[model samples]
Target: MINADARWLRQARSRLRDADPVLARLIDDRPDFDPRAWMAQLPPMDLFGALLFQVAGQQLSVPATRRTLARIEELFDGRLPSAAELLNVEAGQLRAAGLSWRKVGTLRELAERIADGRIDPDGLSRLPDDEVIAELTAIPGIGPWTVQGALLIALRREDVVLPGDLALRKAVKAAYQLDHLPAEPEVLAIAEKWRPYRSLATSYLFSAAIEFSAAIEPAGAPTDAPLRERSTMAATRAGKGRPR
Candidate 1:
């Protein structure tokens, strides 16, 4: 299997630049951009930490996730708590750390499983993507989107795509000039051309969406909106959760 390391990024960039001209322009627009920069800002995480991060981030805006994670860190000396630490904390404490009760249950159960060897992180890293999805999603409140995030951020899989992510769907629509946000199946179809480099394509599309939003915004507009609010206000105002 191809490792999604620095060398993989170079290859992915070359392939992605060749596969789509519009995306190529987007990449060219930001010559020094690094897709992993955002991930770098996050606290270093193992499979367990990555899974918790994904769970914590579900349906929440990025800023909200950051705040929640920050609170969580404060509870554990500015680090993501290990499974034992998580299990030691009260559920109410976790809820106060910004997780919903549903998420609290999910996280606690996940911790329990991991702590007791019901799920093995090292073994999981060895599983195929489908098996990994199956294993993680068996726990309630954990779903495909969460698994997709872990696959990309934690496992560093080369060709992962998060079609269910609202931001991604929006990015795809805006990038491809589609009339509406592409459904998951359509997103998959469009992404077929980006195979083995879909993760890189996703990064470019996200960047393109940001640039498009900025370019089209009326000059002197308020710039204080948080990214998730700015990018997905319509969905949020409509009371929908931002997809993970």
Candidate 2:
């Protein structure tokens, strides 16, 4: 099994350069919006913590999610809970931590899978993007968007596009000034040109999308506002509680 610590990002970055022209320009543009630089500043994170982030962030506002995760930490030993520790927490207590029952179940399942080697976080860093997505999505409650987000954030896979993310679709629509949300087909059509560095372009689009979404908000709103609030509510209202 490949250890995550054995992964080398520089090699991957070189491999991703020509993933596509649109992506290539976004990545190769020297001194032009280096997204990886921001990633570099983030302290090295563990695979388990990354998985917890995925569960906690699912279908919730970022601030709200963080608050909930903090509550979960309080529920634990004042630190991030381990998979074994979480399994011992009751379902009722789990709900009290602000996670839906569905998420609780999903998280528990993920832990079980990891413990049993049905899924391997340490190994995913070495698999190709498509293989990683396939393996992860095979687990119940895991989907394309969740897997895609994990790939970018945890494994730092650079070429995948999440056509199903509403935030991404909304961002693409606003960036291109589309009349409505771009359908998956249209989104894929645009993403096709960004073969290798699609991940970087996707991040830029997500940031730009947040800016666009908040452009029409009330001017008096506090800076504490979170973009995920709208994205989550809209999805929940539309019955999209599947963790985008």
TM-score of each: 0.82, 0.70
Residue 193 local lDDT, model 1: 87
lDDT value, candidate 1, whole model: 0.71
Writing each residue's lDDT as its tens digit, candidate 2 over 104-129 gives 88888987888788877778778888
Task: Tell me how far candidate 1 lies from the true structure as C-alpha RMSD in angstroms.
Answer: 7.3
RMSD to the hidden true structure, all candidates: 7.3, 8.3
**Clash pairs (backbone) in predicted model 2:** 19-195, 19-196, 20-195
Q: Against the correct fold, how does model 1 do in TM-score?
A: 0.82
The candidate maximizing TM-score is 1
